[model samples]
Target chain A: MVDIPILMIGKNVVVPIQTELNDIGAKKMQEDVLYKIEKTTASGLVIDVSAVSIIDSFLGRILVDTSKMAKLMGTESVIVGMKKEVVLTLIQLGLRMENLNTALNLEDGLNLLRKLQETLHGKISG
Target chain B: MEKYQDSRDSGQGQSVSTTIFVASYEDVIVARQKVRELMNEMKFSLLDQTRVVTAVSELSRNIIVHAGKGEMTIIKYDESGRRGFRCIFEDKGPGIADIDLAMREGYSTTNSLGLGLSGSKKLCKNFSIQSTRGKGTRIEIAEWK
Candidate 1:
Protein backbone atom coordinates (compact mmCIF):
# COMPACT_ATOMS: atom_id res chain seq x y z
CA MET A 1 0.00 0.00 0.00
CA VAL A 2 1.15 3.58 -0.65
CA ASP A 3 -0.40 5.53 2.20
CA ILE A 4 1.49 8.41 3.88
CA PRO A 5 0.61 11.35 6.09
CA ILE A 6 0.66 14.99 5.00
CA LEU A 7 0.30 17.67 7.64
CA MET A 8 0.45 21.44 7.94
CA ILE A 9 3.29 23.19 9.71
CA GLY A 10 2.67 26.91 9.76
CA LYS A 11 2.67 27.78 6.04
CA ASN A 12 4.36 24.59 4.97
CA VAL A 13 3.34 21.02 4.12
CA VAL A 14 5.13 18.21 5.92
CA VAL A 15 5.00 14.78 4.28
CA PRO A 16 6.27 11.83 6.25
CA ILE A 17 7.18 8.79 4.16
CA GLN A 18 6.86 6.25 6.92
CA THR A 19 6.66 3.14 4.74
CA GLU A 20 7.41 1.75 1.32
CA LEU A 21 5.14 3.49 -1.16
CA ASN A 22 4.27 1.91 -4.48
CA ASP A 23 3.95 3.91 -7.68
CA ILE A 24 0.20 4.33 -7.33
CA GLY A 25 0.48 5.75 -3.81
CA ALA A 26 3.21 8.20 -4.77
CA LYS A 27 1.25 9.47 -7.79
CA LYS A 28 -1.72 10.14 -5.53
CA MET A 29 0.55 11.87 -3.04
CA GLN A 30 1.84 14.20 -5.75
CA GLU A 31 -1.70 15.25 -6.61
CA ASP A 32 -2.73 15.79 -3.00
CA VAL A 33 0.40 17.79 -2.17
CA LEU A 34 0.18 20.07 -5.20
CA TYR A 35 -3.47 20.81 -4.44
CA LYS A 36 -2.68 21.71 -0.84
CA ILE A 37 0.29 23.82 -1.84
CA GLU A 38 -1.87 25.92 -4.15
CA LYS A 39 -4.82 26.20 -1.78
CA THR A 40 -2.78 27.06 1.29
CA THR A 41 -0.21 29.08 -0.64
CA ALA A 42 2.48 27.28 1.27
CA SER A 43 6.12 28.23 0.91
CA GLY A 44 7.82 24.93 1.67
CA LEU A 45 7.40 21.15 1.51
CA VAL A 46 9.44 18.95 3.86
CA ILE A 47 9.32 15.20 3.14
CA ASP A 48 10.38 13.19 6.18
CA VAL A 49 11.86 9.87 5.06
CA SER A 50 13.74 8.78 8.16
CA ALA A 51 11.52 5.74 8.45
CA VAL A 52 11.67 4.67 4.81
CA SER A 53 13.87 1.60 4.39
CA ILE A 54 13.59 0.90 0.70
CA ILE A 55 13.58 3.36 -2.18
CA ASP A 56 13.87 2.27 -5.81
CA SER A 57 14.96 4.56 -8.61
CA PHE A 58 11.35 4.93 -9.66
CA LEU A 59 10.38 6.27 -6.23
CA GLY A 60 13.42 8.50 -6.30
CA ARG A 61 12.17 9.89 -9.62
CA ILE A 62 8.78 10.59 -8.08
CA LEU A 63 10.40 12.67 -5.35
CA VAL A 64 12.19 14.73 -7.95
CA ASP A 65 8.91 15.14 -9.83
CA THR A 66 7.15 16.31 -6.67
CA SER A 67 9.89 18.86 -6.05
CA LYS A 68 9.53 20.19 -9.60
CA MET A 69 5.77 20.50 -9.22
CA ALA A 70 6.16 22.29 -5.90
CA LYS A 71 8.77 24.62 -7.31
CA LEU A 72 6.51 25.64 -10.16
CA MET A 73 3.76 26.38 -7.67
CA GLY A 74 6.08 28.68 -5.66
CA THR A 75 6.87 26.13 -2.97
CA GLU A 76 10.34 24.88 -2.15
CA SER A 77 10.52 21.12 -1.56
CA VAL A 78 13.07 19.75 0.92
CA ILE A 79 13.63 16.07 1.73
CA VAL A 80 14.74 15.47 5.30
CA GLY A 81 15.95 12.66 7.55
CA MET A 82 17.21 10.30 4.86
CA LYS A 83 18.93 7.23 6.31
CA LYS A 84 22.62 6.80 5.61
CA GLU A 85 22.10 3.49 3.83
CA VAL A 86 19.39 4.98 1.69
CA VAL A 87 21.81 7.66 0.55
CA LEU A 88 24.48 5.10 -0.27
CA THR A 89 22.05 2.98 -2.26
CA LEU A 90 20.76 6.00 -4.14
CA ILE A 91 24.29 6.87 -5.16
CA GLN A 92 25.03 3.31 -6.20
CA LEU A 93 21.92 3.26 -8.39
CA GLY A 94 23.64 6.06 -10.37
CA LEU A 95 20.51 8.15 -10.24
CA ARG A 96 21.41 11.63 -9.25
CA MET A 97 17.88 12.92 -9.09
CA GLU A 98 17.93 16.54 -10.20
CA ASN A 99 16.12 19.41 -8.44
CA LEU A 100 15.71 17.59 -5.16
CA ASN A 101 17.05 19.44 -2.10
CA THR A 102 17.62 17.70 1.20
CA ALA A 103 18.38 18.42 4.86
CA LEU A 104 19.34 16.52 7.98
CA ASN A 105 15.90 16.48 9.58
CA LEU A 106 12.54 18.19 9.84
CA GLU A 107 13.98 21.04 11.89
CA ASP A 108 16.77 21.60 9.40
CA GLY A 109 14.33 21.43 6.52
CA LEU A 110 12.15 24.09 8.12
CA ASN A 111 15.13 26.33 8.68
CA LEU A 112 16.23 25.84 5.10
CA LEU A 113 12.79 26.75 3.84
CA ARG A 114 12.72 29.88 6.02
CA LYS A 115 16.14 30.95 4.82
CA LEU A 116 15.19 30.41 1.19
CA GLN A 117 12.01 32.40 1.76
CA GLU A 118 13.94 35.22 3.34
CA THR A 119 16.38 35.31 0.46
CA LEU A 120 13.57 35.26 -2.05
CA HIS A 121 11.78 38.04 -0.28
CA GLY A 122 14.91 40.10 0.16
CA LYS A 123 15.93 39.76 -3.47
CA ILE A 124 12.49 40.28 -5.03
CA SER A 125 11.37 43.56 -3.48
CA GLY A 126 8.71 41.99 -1.28
CA MET B 1 28.50 -8.51 -12.39
CA GLU B 2 30.71 -9.94 -9.66
CA LYS B 3 30.08 -13.14 -7.67
CA TYR B 4 31.94 -13.57 -4.39
CA GLN B 5 32.42 -16.25 -1.74
CA ASP B 6 29.32 -18.26 -0.80
CA SER B 7 28.82 -19.44 2.78
CA ARG B 8 25.99 -21.85 2.17
CA ASP B 9 28.09 -24.99 2.72
CA SER B 10 28.26 -24.41 6.49
CA GLY B 11 24.50 -24.82 6.92
CA GLN B 12 24.70 -28.30 8.49
CA GLY B 13 22.30 -30.20 6.25
CA GLN B 14 19.44 -28.09 4.94
CA SER B 15 18.40 -24.52 5.48
CA VAL B 16 14.78 -23.49 5.71
CA SER B 17 15.23 -21.15 2.77
CA THR B 18 11.95 -19.64 1.78
CA THR B 19 10.75 -19.85 -1.83
CA ILE B 20 8.35 -17.11 -2.88
CA PHE B 21 6.17 -17.14 -5.99
CA VAL B 22 6.17 -14.00 -8.07
CA ALA B 23 3.01 -14.21 -10.14
CA SER B 24 1.52 -10.89 -9.00
CA TYR B 25 2.24 -7.65 -7.18
CA GLU B 26 1.03 -9.03 -3.84
CA ASP B 27 3.75 -11.64 -3.84
CA VAL B 28 6.38 -8.93 -4.18
CA ILE B 29 5.17 -7.27 -0.97
CA VAL B 30 5.23 -10.59 0.84
CA ALA B 31 8.79 -11.19 -0.28
CA ARG B 32 9.82 -7.72 0.86
CA GLN B 33 8.32 -8.28 4.32
CA LYS B 34 9.98 -11.67 4.65
CA VAL B 35 13.35 -10.25 3.62
CA ARG B 36 12.98 -7.42 6.12
CA GLU B 37 12.28 -9.88 8.93
CA LEU B 38 15.34 -11.96 8.07
CA MET B 39 17.50 -8.84 7.93
CA ASN B 40 16.10 -7.52 11.20
CA GLU B 41 16.84 -10.80 12.98
CA MET B 42 20.36 -10.64 11.62
CA LYS B 43 20.69 -7.19 13.25
CA PHE B 44 21.52 -5.46 9.98
CA SER B 45 21.65 -1.70 10.22
CA LEU B 46 18.54 0.08 8.96
CA LEU B 47 20.38 1.24 5.84
CA ASP B 48 21.72 -2.21 5.00
CA GLN B 49 18.32 -3.72 5.62
CA THR B 50 16.69 -1.16 3.39
CA ARG B 51 19.24 -1.70 0.65
CA VAL B 52 18.56 -5.43 0.50
CA VAL B 53 14.82 -4.86 0.70
CA THR B 54 14.94 -2.37 -2.15
CA ALA B 55 16.94 -4.80 -4.26
CA VAL B 56 14.41 -7.52 -3.51
CA SER B 57 11.58 -5.27 -4.59
CA GLU B 58 13.26 -4.42 -7.86
CA LEU B 59 14.13 -8.02 -8.73
CA SER B 60 10.73 -9.37 -7.75
CA ARG B 61 9.00 -6.71 -9.78
CA ASN B 62 11.16 -7.54 -12.76
CA ILE B 63 10.09 -11.16 -12.50
CA ILE B 64 6.47 -10.16 -12.79
CA VAL B 65 6.77 -7.49 -15.47
CA HIS B 66 9.47 -8.99 -17.67
CA ALA B 67 8.94 -12.67 -17.09
CA GLY B 68 5.51 -14.21 -16.60
CA LYS B 69 5.93 -16.04 -13.32
CA GLY B 70 9.04 -16.87 -11.35
CA GLU B 71 10.41 -17.80 -7.95
CA MET B 72 12.90 -16.41 -5.41
CA THR B 73 14.75 -17.81 -2.41
CA ILE B 74 15.89 -16.05 0.76
CA ILE B 75 18.63 -17.85 2.64
CA LYS B 76 20.97 -16.84 5.44
CA TYR B 77 24.65 -17.16 4.58
CA ASP B 78 27.91 -17.27 6.58
CA GLU B 79 31.07 -17.34 4.46
CA SER B 80 34.69 -16.44 5.30
CA GLY B 81 33.82 -15.26 8.81
CA ARG B 82 31.10 -12.93 7.44
CA ARG B 83 27.45 -13.46 8.26
CA GLY B 84 24.58 -12.01 6.19
CA PHE B 85 21.67 -12.86 3.88
CA ARG B 86 21.40 -13.77 0.20
CA CYS B 87 18.50 -13.73 -2.25
CA ILE B 88 18.25 -15.74 -5.46
CA PHE B 89 15.72 -14.84 -8.16
CA GLU B 90 14.98 -17.31 -10.94
CA ASP B 91 12.61 -17.11 -13.85
CA LYS B 92 11.76 -19.47 -16.71
CA GLY B 93 10.70 -16.53 -18.84
CA PRO B 94 12.53 -15.40 -21.94
CA GLY B 95 16.07 -14.69 -20.77
CA ILE B 96 18.23 -11.71 -21.50
CA ALA B 97 20.49 -12.09 -24.55
CA ASP B 98 23.27 -9.57 -23.94
CA ILE B 99 24.22 -9.49 -20.29
CA ASP B 100 26.88 -6.91 -20.92
CA LEU B 101 24.34 -4.61 -22.54
CA ALA B 102 21.82 -5.18 -19.80
CA MET B 103 24.40 -4.27 -17.18
CA ARG B 104 25.01 -0.89 -18.75
CA GLU B 105 23.57 2.19 -17.09
CA GLY B 106 20.82 4.22 -18.77
CA TYR B 107 19.56 1.24 -20.78
CA SER B 108 15.99 0.04 -20.66
CA THR B 109 13.83 -2.42 -22.59
CA THR B 110 10.60 -0.60 -21.75
CA ASN B 111 9.79 3.07 -21.32
CA SER B 112 9.51 3.74 -17.57
CA LEU B 113 13.24 4.48 -17.93
CA GLY B 114 13.41 1.30 -15.98
CA LEU B 115 16.57 1.06 -13.91
CA GLY B 116 16.37 -2.58 -15.00
CA LEU B 117 19.49 -4.57 -14.08
CA SER B 118 22.45 -2.34 -13.41
CA GLY B 119 20.88 -0.52 -10.49
CA SER B 120 20.26 -3.74 -8.61
CA LYS B 121 23.83 -4.85 -9.18
CA LYS B 122 25.15 -1.66 -7.65
CA LEU B 123 23.08 -2.00 -4.49
CA CYS B 124 24.66 -5.24 -3.34
CA LYS B 125 28.21 -6.35 -2.49
CA ASN B 126 28.04 -9.61 -4.44
CA PHE B 127 26.03 -9.88 -7.67
CA SER B 128 25.82 -12.48 -10.44
CA ILE B 129 23.56 -13.17 -13.42
CA GLN B 130 23.18 -16.29 -15.62
CA SER B 131 20.69 -16.54 -18.45
CA THR B 132 19.89 -18.70 -21.47
CA ARG B 133 18.00 -17.67 -24.58
CA GLY B 134 14.80 -19.64 -23.97
CA LYS B 135 15.62 -21.32 -20.70
CA GLY B 136 15.60 -18.68 -17.89
CA THR B 137 17.56 -16.26 -15.69
CA ARG B 138 19.08 -16.58 -12.26
CA ILE B 139 20.28 -13.57 -10.24
CA GLU B 140 22.03 -13.84 -6.92
CA ILE B 141 22.72 -10.94 -4.55
CA ALA B 142 24.46 -10.98 -1.21
CA GLU B 143 25.41 -8.45 1.48
CA TRP B 144 27.67 -9.48 4.35
CA LYS B 145 28.14 -8.05 7.79
Candidate 2:
Protein backbone atom coordinates (compact mmCIF):
# COMPACT_ATOMS: atom_id res chain seq x y z
CA MET A 1 0.00 0.00 0.00
CA VAL A 2 1.55 3.31 -1.05
CA ASP A 3 1.22 6.19 1.37
CA ILE A 4 -0.03 9.46 -0.18
CA PRO A 5 1.79 12.39 1.38
CA ILE A 6 -0.06 15.43 2.69
CA LEU A 7 1.77 18.71 3.17
CA MET A 8 0.44 21.73 5.03
CA ILE A 9 1.35 25.17 3.75
CA GLY A 10 0.09 28.22 5.58
CA LYS A 11 -3.69 27.90 6.02
CA ASN A 12 -4.07 25.22 3.39
CA VAL A 13 -3.07 21.56 2.91
CA VAL A 14 -1.78 20.03 -0.36
CA VAL A 15 -1.85 16.34 -1.20
CA PRO A 16 0.18 15.10 -4.18
CA ILE A 17 -0.94 11.67 -5.37
CA GLN A 18 2.22 10.15 -6.79
CA THR A 19 1.09 6.62 -7.68
CA GLU A 20 -1.84 4.55 -8.82
CA LEU A 21 -3.62 3.90 -5.53
CA ASN A 22 -5.39 0.68 -4.75
CA ASP A 23 -8.77 0.70 -3.02
CA ILE A 24 -7.28 0.46 0.45
CA GLY A 25 -4.75 3.17 -0.29
CA ALA A 26 -7.43 5.45 -1.72
CA LYS A 27 -9.63 5.07 1.36
CA LYS A 28 -6.69 5.64 3.62
CA MET A 29 -5.94 8.83 1.74
CA GLN A 30 -9.50 10.07 2.29
CA GLU A 31 -9.26 9.38 6.01
CA ASP A 32 -5.82 10.95 6.32
CA VAL A 33 -6.78 14.05 4.35
CA LEU A 34 -9.84 14.63 6.46
CA TYR A 35 -7.89 14.02 9.65
CA LYS A 36 -5.21 16.46 8.58
CA ILE A 37 -7.82 19.06 7.69
CA GLU A 38 -9.36 18.74 11.12
CA LYS A 39 -6.05 18.70 12.95
CA THR A 40 -4.72 21.78 11.21
CA THR A 41 -8.08 23.53 10.77
CA ALA A 42 -6.95 24.38 7.26
CA SER A 43 -9.01 26.89 5.36
CA GLY A 44 -8.19 25.37 1.96
CA LEU A 45 -7.27 21.97 0.51
CA VAL A 46 -5.53 21.13 -2.77
CA ILE A 47 -5.38 17.58 -4.15
CA ASP A 48 -2.81 17.22 -6.93
CA VAL A 49 -3.32 14.29 -9.31
CA SER A 50 -0.95 15.20 -12.14
CA ALA A 51 0.98 12.01 -11.63
CA VAL A 52 -2.10 9.78 -11.53
CA SER A 53 -2.82 8.23 -14.90
CA ILE A 54 -6.36 7.05 -14.29
CA ILE A 55 -9.36 8.02 -12.18
CA ASP A 56 -11.93 5.27 -12.14
CA SER A 57 -15.37 5.51 -10.59
CA PHE A 58 -14.16 4.40 -7.19
CA LEU A 59 -11.40 6.98 -6.95
CA GLY A 60 -13.62 9.63 -8.51
CA ARG A 61 -16.27 9.04 -5.85
CA ILE A 62 -13.67 9.26 -3.10
CA LEU A 63 -12.46 12.61 -4.39
CA VAL A 64 -15.98 13.97 -4.54
CA ASP A 65 -16.80 12.65 -1.10
CA THR A 66 -13.58 13.99 0.37
CA SER A 67 -14.21 17.45 -1.01
CA LYS A 68 -17.74 17.40 0.35
CA MET A 69 -16.48 16.29 3.76
CA ALA A 70 -13.87 19.01 3.69
CA LYS A 71 -16.55 21.56 2.86
CA LEU A 72 -18.60 20.47 5.85
CA MET A 73 -15.52 21.08 7.98
CA GLY A 74 -15.27 24.62 6.59
CA THR A 75 -12.31 23.91 4.30
CA GLU A 76 -12.66 24.76 0.63
CA SER A 77 -10.98 22.09 -1.53
CA VAL A 78 -9.56 22.31 -5.07
CA ILE A 79 -8.46 19.32 -7.17
CA VAL A 80 -5.50 20.11 -9.42
CA GLY A 81 -3.43 18.64 -12.24
CA MET A 82 -5.86 16.14 -13.73
CA LYS A 83 -4.47 14.78 -16.99
CA LYS A 84 -6.51 15.14 -20.19
CA GLU A 85 -6.95 11.44 -20.69
CA VAL A 86 -8.03 10.93 -17.12
CA VAL A 87 -10.71 13.58 -17.48
CA LEU A 88 -11.91 12.02 -20.72
CA THR A 89 -12.22 8.63 -19.07
CA LEU A 90 -14.07 10.04 -16.09
CA ILE A 91 -16.65 11.63 -18.37
CA GLN A 92 -16.96 8.48 -20.45
CA LEU A 93 -17.65 6.55 -17.24
CA GLY A 94 -20.63 8.85 -16.63
CA LEU A 95 -19.25 9.99 -13.30
CA ARG A 96 -19.95 13.66 -12.84
CA MET A 97 -17.92 15.69 -10.35
CA GLU A 98 -19.63 19.04 -10.66
CA ASN A 99 -19.27 20.20 -7.08
CA LEU A 100 -15.51 20.10 -6.81
CA ASN A 101 -13.32 23.08 -7.69
CA THR A 102 -10.47 22.30 -10.07
CA ALA A 103 -7.32 23.93 -11.50
CA LEU A 104 -4.61 23.02 -13.96
CA ASN A 105 -1.78 22.88 -11.42
CA LEU A 106 -0.77 23.45 -7.81
CA GLU A 107 -0.05 27.15 -8.26
CA ASP A 108 -3.40 27.73 -9.89
CA GLY A 109 -5.09 25.62 -7.25
CA LEU A 110 -3.55 27.71 -4.45
CA ASN A 111 -4.41 30.93 -6.23
CA LEU A 112 -8.04 29.89 -6.64
CA LEU A 113 -8.21 28.98 -2.98
CA ARG A 114 -6.80 32.39 -2.06
CA LYS A 115 -9.42 34.04 -4.21
CA LEU A 116 -12.15 32.00 -2.53
CA GLN A 117 -10.82 33.06 0.89
CA GLU A 118 -10.80 36.69 -0.15
CA THR A 119 -14.39 36.51 -1.36
CA LEU A 120 -15.44 34.94 1.93
CA HIS A 121 -13.51 37.57 3.86
CA GLY A 122 -15.08 40.35 1.87
CA LYS A 123 -18.53 38.92 2.58
CA ILE A 124 -17.75 39.06 6.28
CA SER A 125 -15.89 42.42 6.46
CA GLY A 126 -17.61 44.45 3.74
CA MET B 1 0.98 -13.68 -9.16
CA GLU B 2 0.41 -16.77 -11.32
CA LYS B 3 0.77 -15.74 -14.95
CA TYR B 4 1.66 -17.26 -18.29
CA GLN B 5 1.97 -16.12 -21.90
CA ASP B 6 1.13 -17.91 -25.11
CA SER B 7 0.65 -17.28 -28.82
CA ARG B 8 -2.30 -18.68 -30.73
CA ASP B 9 -3.85 -18.36 -34.16
CA SER B 10 -7.58 -17.86 -34.44
CA GLY B 11 -9.66 -17.43 -37.60
CA GLN B 12 -9.41 -13.69 -37.18
CA GLY B 13 -5.61 -13.57 -36.81
CA GLN B 14 -2.59 -14.45 -34.66
CA SER B 15 -2.55 -13.20 -31.07
CA VAL B 16 -0.42 -13.09 -27.93
CA SER B 17 -2.14 -13.31 -24.59
CA THR B 18 -1.42 -13.20 -20.86
CA THR B 19 -3.60 -14.34 -17.98
CA ILE B 20 -3.45 -12.86 -14.48
CA PHE B 21 -5.26 -14.22 -11.43
CA VAL B 22 -7.33 -11.59 -9.69
CA ALA B 23 -8.00 -12.22 -5.99
CA SER B 24 -7.16 -8.99 -4.23
CA TYR B 25 -7.07 -5.22 -4.63
CA GLU B 26 -3.34 -5.41 -5.25
CA ASP B 27 -4.02 -7.86 -8.05
CA VAL B 28 -6.43 -5.38 -9.58
CA ILE B 29 -3.67 -2.77 -9.70
CA VAL B 30 -1.38 -5.30 -11.32
CA ALA B 31 -4.05 -6.12 -13.88
CA ARG B 32 -4.46 -2.46 -14.79
CA GLN B 33 -0.69 -1.99 -15.14
CA LYS B 34 -0.40 -5.02 -17.41
CA VAL B 35 -3.25 -3.78 -19.57
CA ARG B 36 -1.64 -0.36 -19.83
CA GLU B 37 1.63 -1.93 -20.93
CA LEU B 38 -0.09 -3.99 -23.59
CA MET B 39 -2.07 -0.99 -24.83
CA ASN B 40 1.11 1.06 -25.03
CA GLU B 41 2.79 -1.69 -27.02
CA MET B 42 -0.21 -1.75 -29.36
CA LYS B 43 0.32 1.98 -29.94
CA PHE B 44 -3.06 2.90 -28.49
CA SER B 45 -3.71 6.61 -28.15
CA LEU B 46 -3.34 8.09 -24.68
CA LEU B 47 -7.08 8.65 -24.46
CA ASP B 48 -7.80 5.11 -25.56
CA GLN B 49 -5.24 3.74 -23.09
CA THR B 50 -6.79 5.64 -20.23
CA ARG B 51 -10.26 4.53 -21.23
CA VAL B 52 -9.35 0.86 -21.40
CA VAL B 53 -7.17 0.95 -18.27
CA THR B 54 -9.96 2.57 -16.28
CA ALA B 55 -12.38 -0.07 -17.54
CA VAL B 56 -9.96 -2.78 -16.46
CA SER B 57 -9.76 -1.25 -13.00
CA GLU B 58 -13.54 -1.36 -12.55
CA LEU B 59 -13.98 -4.84 -14.03
CA SER B 60 -11.08 -6.39 -12.10
CA ARG B 61 -12.24 -4.82 -8.86
CA ASN B 62 -15.64 -6.45 -9.41
CA ILE B 63 -13.91 -9.81 -9.18
CA ILE B 64 -12.72 -8.97 -5.68
CA VAL B 65 -15.81 -7.09 -4.58
CA HIS B 66 -18.69 -9.15 -5.97
CA ALA B 67 -16.91 -12.45 -6.41
CA GLY B 68 -14.23 -13.85 -4.13
CA LYS B 69 -11.80 -14.12 -7.04
CA GLY B 70 -11.45 -14.28 -10.81
CA GLU B 71 -9.02 -14.44 -13.72
CA MET B 72 -8.36 -11.86 -16.42
CA THR B 73 -6.96 -12.80 -19.83
CA ILE B 74 -5.53 -9.98 -21.91
CA ILE B 75 -5.04 -10.63 -25.61
CA LYS B 76 -3.27 -8.50 -28.17
CA TYR B 77 -4.69 -9.32 -31.53
CA ASP B 78 -3.66 -8.51 -35.10
CA GLU B 79 -6.70 -9.41 -37.16
CA SER B 80 -6.21 -8.98 -40.91
CA GLY B 81 -4.00 -5.91 -40.38
CA ARG B 82 -6.21 -4.51 -37.59
CA ARG B 83 -4.63 -4.32 -34.15
CA GLY B 84 -6.45 -4.19 -30.82
CA PHE B 85 -6.54 -5.42 -27.23
CA ARG B 86 -9.09 -7.69 -25.55
CA CYS B 87 -9.64 -8.52 -21.88
CA ILE B 88 -11.72 -11.38 -20.51
CA PHE B 89 -12.72 -11.57 -16.83
CA GLU B 90 -14.15 -14.80 -15.43
CA ASP B 91 -15.29 -15.59 -11.88
CA LYS B 92 -16.92 -18.54 -10.09
CA GLY B 93 -18.81 -16.53 -7.51
CA PRO B 94 -22.53 -16.08 -7.07
CA GLY B 95 -23.46 -14.60 -10.39
CA ILE B 96 -25.85 -11.78 -10.98
CA ALA B 97 -29.45 -12.95 -10.93
CA ASP B 98 -30.71 -10.07 -13.02
CA ILE B 99 -28.51 -8.81 -15.81
CA ASP B 100 -30.80 -5.92 -16.75
CA LEU B 101 -30.96 -4.56 -13.23
CA ALA B 102 -27.23 -4.95 -12.77
CA MET B 103 -26.63 -3.09 -16.00
CA ARG B 104 -28.73 -0.18 -14.88
CA GLU B 105 -26.90 2.83 -13.55
CA GLY B 106 -26.94 3.24 -9.75
CA TYR B 107 -27.96 -0.39 -9.29
CA SER B 108 -25.63 -2.07 -6.84
CA THR B 109 -26.04 -4.75 -4.22
CA THR B 110 -22.92 -3.49 -2.55
CA ASN B 111 -22.67 0.09 -1.34
CA SER B 112 -21.05 1.73 -4.35
CA LEU B 113 -21.71 4.22 -7.11
CA GLY B 114 -22.87 1.14 -9.10
CA LEU B 115 -21.16 2.32 -12.28
CA GLY B 116 -18.72 -0.56 -12.72
CA LEU B 117 -20.60 -2.61 -15.27
CA SER B 118 -22.41 0.10 -17.14
CA GLY B 119 -19.54 2.55 -17.02
CA SER B 120 -17.04 0.01 -18.26
CA LYS B 121 -19.33 -0.80 -21.16
CA LYS B 122 -19.31 2.83 -22.18
CA LEU B 123 -15.51 3.04 -21.97
CA CYS B 124 -14.71 0.30 -24.44
CA LYS B 125 -15.53 -0.17 -28.09
CA ASN B 126 -16.89 -3.67 -27.54
CA PHE B 127 -18.39 -5.20 -24.38
CA SER B 128 -20.25 -8.39 -23.50
CA ILE B 129 -21.31 -10.18 -20.32
CA GLN B 130 -22.58 -13.66 -19.47
CA SER B 131 -23.70 -14.73 -16.02
CA THR B 132 -25.75 -17.49 -14.42
CA ARG B 133 -26.99 -17.51 -10.86
CA GLY B 134 -25.01 -19.91 -8.61
CA LYS B 135 -22.77 -20.64 -11.59
CA GLY B 136 -20.34 -17.88 -12.60
CA THR B 137 -19.84 -14.75 -14.68
CA ARG B 138 -17.68 -13.75 -17.62
CA ILE B 139 -17.16 -10.29 -19.08
CA GLU B 140 -15.25 -9.49 -22.25
CA ILE B 141 -14.20 -6.02 -23.36
CA ALA B 142 -12.20 -4.95 -26.38
CA GLU B 143 -10.76 -1.85 -28.01
CA TRP B 144 -9.15 -1.37 -31.43
CA LYS B 145 -6.33 0.90 -32.51
Best by TM-score: 2
> In model 1, which regions exceed 4 Å deviation?
B1-12, B77-85, B143-145
- Whole-model Cα lDDT per candidate? 0.82, 0.93
Off by over 4 Å in 2: B9-13
lDDT of 2 by residue, B24-84 (tens): 9999999999999988887888898899999999999999998889999988877776788
**Residue-pair clashes per candidate, as listed?**
0, 0
- Write down the TM-score for model 2: 0.96
RMSD of each: 4.8, 1.6
**Ten residues in a row with the worst lDDT in model 2 chain B?**
B3-12
Let me know the TM-score candidate 1 reaches against the reference structure.
0.84
Model 1 over residues B36-85: C-alpha lDDT tens digits?
99888888888777777888888888888879789888777544576776
Model 2 chain A worst lDDT window (10 residues) = A1-10
The residue-level lDDT of candidate 2 at B76 comes to: 81
Indicate the residue-level lDDT of A2 in model 1.
54
Output candidate 1 Cα RMSD: 4.8
